[model samples]
Target: MDTSLDDLDHDYAASIADRAMRAMAEQRIPPTPTNFAVWFQYFAGSHDDLRNAIDLLIDHNRPFDARINQDLFETYVAPQVSAVVVDTSERLHELMGTAKDFLATAIADNHSQIQAISDVAGQGQAGVDPKALVAQLMNELARAASRATRLEAGFAEKTRELDVIRDSLSKSEQRARTDTLTGLANRRALDEFLRKAQTTAEWGEPLSVLLLDIDHFKTFNDNFGHGVGDQVLRLMAKVLREKVREQDLSARYGGEELIAVLPDTDLAACTEIAERIRRAIAEAKITRRSTGEVLPGITVSIGVARYRVGETVTDLIERCDRALYLAKGGGRNRVVTENELDRAEAAG
Candidate 1:
């Protein structure tokens, strides 16, 4: 067999093994005898072929160390893998420390060599036969200088490349998370905010969500047409962005619905903010193009719900939805609080 062809085959096999390992880790499968046997059977083939493929993959993906693999496996596969991963990680850390010390020593030596060269050049005395000593020093200095220069250049180049990559990634991420039409965060972004809010609530910070729906938006679309409707939506989004705090998130949650996530905000503050937004929407003057006819005013009904310490994202959303329904039922263009509903029911 051709050597290059064999190498390609080996690489392909290794990639397959790596994918399988990743799958097992993600699934949190333990490497117990039974589990291992099942996994092996699932990826059935000649034992030698499988082993060779795995070995090739391991070699190619040198960063996939035992510690990382084991940690992932523990998180996804089995609890026992945690201890092994921890031990391996500790060992790797120790090795890294030793390597760093070695590098530091080498850098110090190079610095000392450069210093000696400078000292010799500065000395005015020419009587002493410093030829042999000077020659040896010069050779050592040249080697160290060349190595240092190359290392610095390589580091700078890598830094520049990384910065370009980071900027590109940031733009891509912003595009993915933003709503193109309204300039607000999209549904996907809202989901991410909800996840983070849940974490914040767990850490004893208050979280609140406000769901706002433009009252009778479909009627506006039907009367004014979609082009004008889109402009109205954009205007609403602008008002929301201005009204919400820096730490808060405002997103277009599909169609005429929008959501705001307030971290470290209580129910009262959220209600006030929602009311302000509602007022802003009602006061905005939206005009039509063809006949110079100004459309009727717009209004939003808002539902406010605060984090109930141990509530899940879904639970919080449902409560807010219920409040929103009540707001719409009671009247359009008003804010409703979940706590208010509880109080009303109690009084009734």
Candidate 2:
């Protein structure tokens, strides 16, 4: 945090983490900040004596501060840098198309359930066992509903797999950046992209970041298992993919936190997109597969903020973060932007 903060403000954790790993590699020492510092300096070639000592230590025995060194490794190790990768519109459409046919079959077989309609258009009579027929109608509807629900989960899983493959194939440089969990761009990637995007924004193009977090995630995870929690994450990811555009960059910023960087976009444009995503997720129903019980559905809180000239990525992120908290504070399942926050502040 000392002098490093000055140069590493862009990505504090990532920079130190990367250096710490390399330092550990060169020194062949256990990962510790003390060992990291000695080797961090050694790799930079700033101190000849320390570098020589580390070099000698690479072949010779050495001692390091165990606690501090361990802390450094735990703190910095680059945090599992993840990459974003996915394609969903195609598969989703296919499943939905197939589901539509299933739904039609269910409805046709159960036409008598409709109070206003006849089993045969003009035939005004439903000639079947009211009990067994009712059971049969329920079975067909349940089957169709189950098919759609299963597809929803499969869609999420396939989307994540596709994302991982896409990044692996075309974005070879980003291979190390892929997150193991969600397959979305990791926090490190988000920071890297912000650094470059900031450079272009300084020239006057609009830039914005939408900070998003899942609502009641903990309650859901606790009520269901972590497996269902993962399902919710994938569900949100698919929604993000559906709503995302060609120029947009979406990333998983740790836990249930996410981000969508929209270059050449303003607050209004960004808010509109956020609302669309909010509504889309709100309307979708996710059912428990183990039991037919309907679990509480998913919702997200979003904070939209546009970049300002001369601001660091940290500042931009912080403002957006504050707005995101505002969205969370006001109520869950809503979008709050810096524009609205500014207005509220001015009035107060």
Candidate 3:
């Protein structure tokens, strides 16, 4: 025996082989020489190697353990382990060839027998021997057929489980990227959008960003309470989404502040979109659905900045934020551009 084989725990192999044989017997499969050969092969080989060999043998209609055990030992094991290695090698080769021929013949015979039985069964004759009928059924359908069915069912179940897992993960991802209060994209989502927008801008596709803040928001919260203030915020988000193009992204940037990312858009287009959003908010009649109490109207001060070549997403956002500050300083309901910032800086 090879040193590796010797090192292997034979007891474990023997136990497994024994259990396998017992299972076969319980299934009423006759313990033939071929079956013993297969069992011996499984016991002597590594688990993975044994499994592969068994699968091949089963496909070839030579799955009986005795047949595998006898063939494997004669063809591979005996030669490697025997004291008279030369003689063992010659004998192993001869026996292996003989086993191959024997298996081919057995398979042909079994096929012929099955065909004959199937023809007889198809005739629908009465008074056929029940045991013979059962044997025919087992040979034709029961053996290995049930295993295939089980494997298919197991695969389908696993597929369903994977789909469910994927759906749960998708929902979790959405929650992580969204603001809970306004049901809009949050800062995390905005950062991702900005990074993508920056890449597009580098590719010669202009990108624009808008930063807008609700005017006098603190006073609304103070006078009408936080609940009404929240209602106003939600309504504003709805209007922003409704007004912005499908390609644009709207996000809530902390309290009373929002941001929009517009891909392939210039400063003028972004300003127009911002104005539309502003007009929508000014015209919207947002009252407490629960209380029917009219809430104070709101307006947004917006800053529009086109992404400059070689500028980072952070730089564009900061410039837009500064422009928004300027808009607030100027009036509170107007749109300010980065050009205005340049003019202001030059004047200063």
Please name the candidate that would achieve the greatest lDDT relative to the true structure: 3
Using lDDT, rank the candidates from best to worst.
3, 1, 2
* Candidates, ranked, TM-score: 3, 1, 2
Error of 1 at 32 (Å): 51
How does candidate 3 score on lDDT? 0.72
Residue by residue across 1-348, what tens digits does model 2's lDDT show?
A: 222334545666466568857656544344433345544544445455554544564565554433333333224333212222223345455656766766575566445345323332333245555666556566656765676676567667666766755555566546445544466675667778888889999999999989889998868876886567777787887788679797688887756788889899988999999999999989989877778678887889999999999989889988898888889989889999998888877888
lDDT of each: 0.72, 0.69, 0.72
Q: Is candidate 1 or candidate 3 better by TM-score?
A: 3
TM-score top scorer: 3
Candidate 2: regions farther than 4 A off: 1-173
lDDT of 1 by residue, 199-307 (tens): 8789888889899988998787767665687788889999999999998999987567788999999899999999999999999888876777888999999999998
Candidate 2's displacement at residue 186, Å, is 0.7
Where does model 3 exceed 4 Å of error?
1-140
Cα lDDT for residue 75, model 3?
Answer: 57
| Cα RMSD (angstroms) for every candidate in the order listed | 14.8, 22.0, 26.5
Candidate 1 structure, TM-score to reference: 0.57
lDDT of 3 at 227: 63
Q: Which scores greater on TM-score, model 2 or model 3?
A: 3
